[model samples]
Target: MIQRLLFAGLLSGLVVALFAFSFARVYAEPTIERAISLEEGGAHKHAAVEKGTISRSTQRNAGLFTGVAAYCTALGGFLAIGMAFLHGRLSVRPRSAVWTLALTGYVALVLVPQLKYPASPPGVGSAETIGVRTELYFVMILASAVCMAASVWIAFRIRRRMGMALSLAIATGLLVALAAVLMTIMPAVSETPRDFPRGLLFEFRLHAALMQLIVWGGLGFLFGRVAEHVVEHDRPAGVVRHRIPNA
Candidate 1:
């Protein structure tokens, strides 16, 4: 199970690579010359200049290394803990405990830095335009939350795993839903932040919400297997007490 999860994490890293490549817009040069040739005056030249700036921002971030590195790093961390647990060096309880922390910490670590900049602000780019948008990163952030929630379920399946299971589920469910809704609204609101509505439904993004369900289902099967193994190890030792014999 540890090996398989590790492999899954590695595979996920590869998937990140595909997204990275797809986002590569480094050399997408605009017909700046063509536009200038046709219209030497009017608002067309100024608009072209503004577009050039957005395009340049797109080029600077079109690399694939960053995405794959982040995915592999998280997966590797989870797999390392799983290995220690498998080898008995790490107690099942500790393994179970850290899984929760690892997921939450990883999500924050990946996301917080993405939001630390000014240009990376929300709703500021087109779908084809590349850069770490807050909404998009939030979508990916659900991956770890979902993983940890399953780990909680694994803990629940054991003698005392129930509490953690329910707690993690509720937490993960909420995050997933929030992430999904943000994906939908971020794109729209980003396009027109000035006109975005501030109502009751403003809490969540559409893409992030729907993704939570998927995250839960996949993690459910994974953590179940981990729980089974952990429980087997934690089983009480057999007794060999001698019975009193009748005279």
Candidate 2:
């Protein structure tokens, strides 16, 4: 069962790579190029190529595809494991379970942390502070994941007594309050240069967010279908076997 799920996940990853790569190539690559150009100040156009380093063209093409493929592949494996654990626990259809997990994952892993430490293009922040920035960003993700898990547990625990709607409401309120407190307490990080083009920054971040949406949304949709098929196929023989009519 785990092997089948893993295969499904890897397959989904490969399928999603095509869409993600195309979107990034069309929407994100230009913004990245502009940022790189700004970083170089129009100089060193050929320095990297001449120095035997990978050129921007290669990075944006084959490199981009490879990186996306790798990321999605690993994500798919994790998603499969999550599905295995959550399969019957959610009391929902397989498709619903997969999508719910994906949505919650995106919020906890990406959206929450991003709100605190939004992604910056190359050359936006000081290299000296990168370690600190990375540590803080991961801390935010960890905190957000913990809050999400707690909320889910609370909702499940009280749903029978308080009712699903009210339990969910309470859990949501708790999550929001915890998120707000974390945001307020975490140290702020502003690394964009004063002279940086605001419009470019906005566009870059927008593209980044859209790319993530594509990755998560695509995975959910694809894996949901696969999971549905797997569940139908794997039904216990007793459930499907015809009983002799009191012979």
- TM-scores for all candidates? 0.30, 0.90
Query: Clashing pairs in model 2?
Result: none
lDDT of each: 0.40, 0.84
Candidate 2: tens digits of C-alpha lDDT, residues 36-150:
7777773323222122288888999999999999988888888888988876566567788789889988988999899889888765877678889999999999999999999
Error of 2 at 11 (Å): 1.0
Specify the highest-TM-score model's number. Answer: 2
Tens digit of lDDT per residue, candidate 1, span 1-247?
4555455544444443444333332211122222233333432222222334444334435423454356544554454455446443333443353344344544443432223221212222334444445555555445434544554444445423345446457656655555455444543323323322332113222222222222322233344345445545555678432422211
Model 1: residues >4 Å from true position, as ranges? 1-87, 94-98, 109-129, 132-192, 197-227, 230-247
Predicted structure 1: lDDT:
0.40
Residue 44: error of model 2 in Å? 15
lDDT of 1 at 130: 45
Q: How much is the lDDT of residue 199 in candidate 2?
A: 90
Residue 207 CA displacement from its true place in model 1, Å: 5.2
Best by lDDT: 2
